[model samples]
Target chain A: GESVGLHLPTLSVQEGDNSIINCAYSNSASDYFIWYKQESGKGPQFIIDIRSNMDKRQGQRVTVLLNKTVKHLSLQIAATQPGDSAVYFCAEGRDSNYQLIWGAGTKLIIKP
Target chain B: EADIYQTPRYLVIGTGKKITLECSQTMGHDKMYWYQQDPGMELHLIHYSYGVNSTEKGDLSSESTVSRIRTEHFPLTLESARPSHTSQYLCASSDFMGSRETQYFGPGTRLLVL
Candidate 1:
């Protein structure tokens, strides 16, 4: 019964604006969370990741926030550009295994 | 960039034919995985291997079989390809550093069974 899901299927944002994608998970025992970006016809690329003990983590142009109380995770992208447009997925890892449970991806669209 | 690679970036095959999806990584990662994804859908783990000769089925039940005979190569085979097996197969690898090790992925193989 462990599953991860996104709050929205698509998000449209103006170029240079910020984008926020949300994810929720049902397994409280999951200790690791990761964010991935998948371009069309390509595999999921690792963007950033955070542990259960951390509430927030930042990358070059992205940030991942984890809220354990509500079982929510969010990825924030700054200065959204056309090249930044892609499907973003959030995954949670079980403590006993290395496999990741993926969430429904959120498609980020950038408008000129 | 990740050094992972998948062969036959796109494949169109007839039903009942056998097919193998090749995946290789030059990063020397100890963990490798195979995931299935439909168009505009999330990924589902089909198989994984912690090291050579250690293969395990993932959460999703898949008819595809995988072998880890070498450290850099993990291939998945479909004994009989079916229309229902049409999907994109992604290969990923990660080191056994810790729980939060980042997974690097290859460009994936898109298979269409006619």
Candidate 2:
């Protein structure tokens, strides 16, 4: 059974500080990984993604790092702000049908 | 920001009642998906469609059925809703370019079966 899981259920960080959310995946065959942000009462929004061929990818102030050796994925948000307070999720995509295996979300809270 | 839309943002219905969740996308994406999520829980894929007239069941087993007669519209129908079906339903659409496929989601529908 393939599954994705988060290291922490909730993470608290101060504003203007960097935040790191970690995820672990069980499938070695998964080649694509994605990060999504879900605001309260809203659907998840795409943040960043990384392919197995690459080690890291950056988008705006967000960065995604993938370590295929350890089957780990991380999302780095620089200068965490109040707007960054949301639930973050990591998903792994297999070759078939492009369906993604989602993990339990990590709630990122920014302290004022 | 995605053009995807879901109707009946909040619904409260009795058990055994019929209900339908509407989902539509203006992006002309070839892929569409329906996901169920409980509060503070992981998302479970319930249904997905590759294109018009092509629908498939996802990883999770669901009692609801879906129809994709038009490219932009994909709706889910629950013939006999139950209390166990109470949850948030999200709709998403994606268009892949080569190996890059990103799903854009809509504001989910919150269903409460009383």
Candidate 3:
């Protein structure tokens, strides 16, 4: 069963600091990846996405890095804020029918 | 903003009750998906539809069923809700925008089987 998984269950960060969330995927056939931010009692929101051909992609204050060699993916958020606290999840997708494989989320906690 | 909507944001029902979670999207997307997620857990795909009159089960084995009679609406029905079915249901829709298909999600419905 090919799946996506996160390295940490929770991450505590202070305001104005940079936060990094790591993910590992088992499927080599996956070509696209996405990061989602899910707040309490809400659905997951799109954050950033990266394709396998590229190594890094940046958007606003968020950046997504993909390493196909190690099958690793990471999301970095700059200037963490209280509003940035949420559960972050990484999803992997293949070319067949565009079905996405989800990873267990990592809780991001911001300390004021 | 995405035009996806889900009804009954929160639900608390007894065991063996029948329940249907309604999901509708005005984005005119050809793809729709249903996912079940527990608190602080990963989302499991339960069902999905490629288009109107097309429905398929996802990676997860779920007791619920879904119908795609209309392109903009996809509803999931549970014949007998049990304690194990207590979870959050999320609906999403995506257009056939070539290779990069970004899925827009709706506010989820939280279910509690008492």
Task: Kindly give the number of clashing pairs for every candidate.
Answer: 0, 0, 0
- Model 3 lDDT per residue over A37-61, tens place: 9999889998888888999999999
Which residue runs does candidate 3 get wrong by more than 4 Å?
Answer: none
**Model 3 chain A lowest lDDT segment of ten:** A92-101
**CA lDDT scores, all candidates in order:** 0.92, 0.93, 0.92
A-chain TM-score, model 2? 0.97
- For B43-109, candidate 3 gives per-residue lDDT tens digits of 9999999999999999888799999999999999999999999999999998745457788899999
TM-score of each: 0.96, 0.97, 0.97
Output the number of the DockQ-best candidate.
Answer: 3
Error of 1 at B90 (Å): 0.4
Clashes of 2: 0
Clashing pairs in 3: none
Model 2 agreement with the true structure over B1-114: per-residue lDDT tens digits: 899999989999999999999999999998999999998789999999999999999878879999999999999999999999999999999977557678899999999999
TM-score of chain A of 1: 0.97
**Model 1 CA lDDT for position A91:** 92
Q: What tens-digit string does per-residue lDDT give for candidate 1 at A3-101?
A: 999999999999999999999999999889999999998888888888999999999989999999999999999999899989999999856777788
Output the lDDT of residue A18, model 3: 100
